[model samples]
Target: MGEAYKLDCDICAYTENIFVGFGLLYMRLESIASFVQDAALKRRIEEFIGNPSTRYDAYDALYVCPVCQAIRNELFIEMESDSSQYKISYACPRCASVMQQEHIENNVPVHLSCPACEKGKLKATFYMDWD
Candidate 1:
């Protein structure tokens, strides 16, 4: 076992005692962020793609708005469309508008504050566990 730590959100007084283990909320983000080499990432992609047994329904990516910090992923592809086929585009689900190009990224920090928080918005966080 590793050391655990507390993550606190000052705005809403949100606090979580996080332990270093499996099934954590940010596992996906941590795993992706831990990737050190482009070649390793390429190899991982190749392993999934080059293998004839592999079956992917669709390739997905994520994007976020710098302004509102709203998340827009491949799911938002429907909400927005791009003429270029290069990158997965997104539309703000909350705003129902296209996110600016510069605001998009392949990946970003999942946790962020709501823009409306300062505008009197309340953000909620939830945690569940195995019984």
Candidate 2:
């Protein structure tokens, strides 16, 4: 099952509703590939479909840009097939810097700094279960 969260920053009043985890629909290769808007990324993911040796994981995840302190909720996908790594890394839309995955514990994000203010921590509030 997947989960949804409302992340808020008390001091800055920054807020965002995000969904995390893979749902049943994510099991299909076509479904997963569709989530990727980049043509190159979509092609790479499609190649892994139905391959016995292909090992992959797909989920909704939170990413933070280290350079710009921007936050993004994105579909996270990683795969390894035929000794080739297919890890997905997101670039900060604002700064063009490589973004880092945010830490989550017990389905809740932890140690997250507010991307808006950069002074307050983010609080994750669970809203519901999905899939």
Candidate 3:
């Protein structure tokens, strides 16, 4: 049998590397801020600094599917009719199914089939993220 080695905690390095990387990132951010000269960007930064509550809304309001629970971003499309109102449509990322907003809101899958089981059990959900 081979000789066993004793565990040594003193030799182990446990320092956080992420914090060092973040410090370097902050340096890079300062350099980038010096290069940016757009007036709109400056105004936006000032607004964010002055009134933090006036932040951009991250979520795109959408209807989700009932079966598969897929999240879809709602987009407005003008209808062929004379009405000025636009119709909403939801698209599934996995199945590439384009469904009308009314049907998706009602929890119905209009044009997508599940690739795994070949069943029409697709669903949708809405999601949002901050910039």
Candidate 4:
């Protein structure tokens, strides 16, 4: 037997329960720079950090649905009932367009919808999540 390990996410305050044994060695890796020593790992990490899926900073652009011509807000509220779910009900400050949030896999700036126009738009927004 080795030891038990725990991983904590600061943003969500979510902790992952992990058990480590001699058969399956467990290591606590920290920082992107330290994890990837090999060229391939470094490249992969760099690519992952650069990709929007791994990082939200790449998706900071505002989006507008052509069908409705409405500018959607990036700020969204998460549904407390479900940890994996979120909802965007803020009306567009510009066009007063009703906005709804939609989850698309593992990405940021979730999809937005307008009831009046029935347009599914996406934008980069911020939301507060506590666990």
Candidate 5:
């Protein structure tokens, strides 16, 4: 895998997960430069295409934030969760509402649903910080 970058929206400060997600989708294509039939366009693709190890520079090539790219690709499915990062930053501003809900069922605490994901909950857990 190449370097992982967290791209934030300039306007909302929301990360453009979809843009990075779709870029990741296309990076799987071998010889991505081959898709363009036009020599001029093909040349341009090669000019800015990053090394396989440090891909994703393209996300910032044309826009300050990738969300402005306005992409709509069906291949944008199958996004991998950046769960490890989320584990550390669960109190993001967007989750403030979800963080306050708690209920007990059958003597077990059932965490409330996350507003952003609509399927997660807040839980306090400990881990050795490796970084």
Candidate 6:
């Protein structure tokens, strides 16, 4: 099952919600491939589905833009081809910077600098179960 979390700023009103983990449909290779927005990435995932030798992992997760400190919720997909070469990068929607994956597991708090109010800290709080 998946999980939902809400991030609230300790000193400001900044708030955002993120959903992470796998749903029932995510278990299906085709469905997971379809969920990827990048055409090239989707094709790579499809190739992995066709040949199971190439390992792959896909999930809904939080991503942070190092340059702008922006937060984004997106489908994180990774797949290695037979040649053991696979590369995927997600650009920050706000600043066009590369985004790094962040995990919110077991309801552990993910402390972050608030994108909206930089002075405040964003605290991740488990809200509910999803999927």
Query: Could you give the C-alpha RMSD of every candidate to the true structure, in order shown?
Result: 12.5, 2.0, 19.4, 18.6, 16.4, 2.0
**Per-residue lDDT of candidate 3, residues 1-131 (tens digit):** 11111111222321110000012212322332344365544343333333333322111233444455454443222222232222335556665566433233223343434334444433433222122
Of candidates 2 and 1, the better by TM-score: 2
Q: Which lDDT tens digits does candidate 6 get at residues 73-112?
A: 8886677767665656789988898899888876566667
The deviation in Å at residue 100 for candidate 4 is: 4.1
* Model 1 misplacement above 4 A: 1-8, 13-62, 72-85, 100-112, 119-131
TM-score to native of every candidate shown = 0.28, 0.87, 0.23, 0.22, 0.20, 0.84
Give me the runs in candidate 4 sitting further than 4 Å from their true place.
1-67, 81-86, 100-131
Task: Evaluate all candidate structures by whole-model CA lDDT and list the values in order.
Answer: 0.36, 0.83, 0.32, 0.34, 0.28, 0.80
- Candidate 3 residue spans exceeding 4 A from truth: 1-60, 76-86, 99-131
Estimate, for each residue in 1-131, the C-alpha lDDT of model 5 and write its tens digit: 21223333323423322112224325532354555355754454454444343232212111111212221211111112223111101122422321221222222442333233333442322221211
The best candidate in terms of TM-score: 2
The sequence of per-residue lDDT tens digits that candidate 1 reaches over residues 7-119 is 33546554444332223222333233244245544344344433344332222233446557564332111111222122234557776666643221112322544343433
Candidate 2: list runs displaced more than 4 Å.
106-109
lDDT of 1: 0.36
Question: Which 10-residue span in candidate 4 carries the lowest summed lDDT?
Answer: 20-29
Model 5 weakest lDDT span, ten residues long: 83-92
Q: Rank the candidates by TM-score, best first.
A: 2, 6, 1, 3, 4, 5
lDDT of 6 at 76: 68
Q: Against the correct fold, how does model 6 do in TM-score?
A: 0.84
TM-score, candidate 2, is: 0.87
Ranking by lDDT: 2, 6, 1, 4, 3, 5
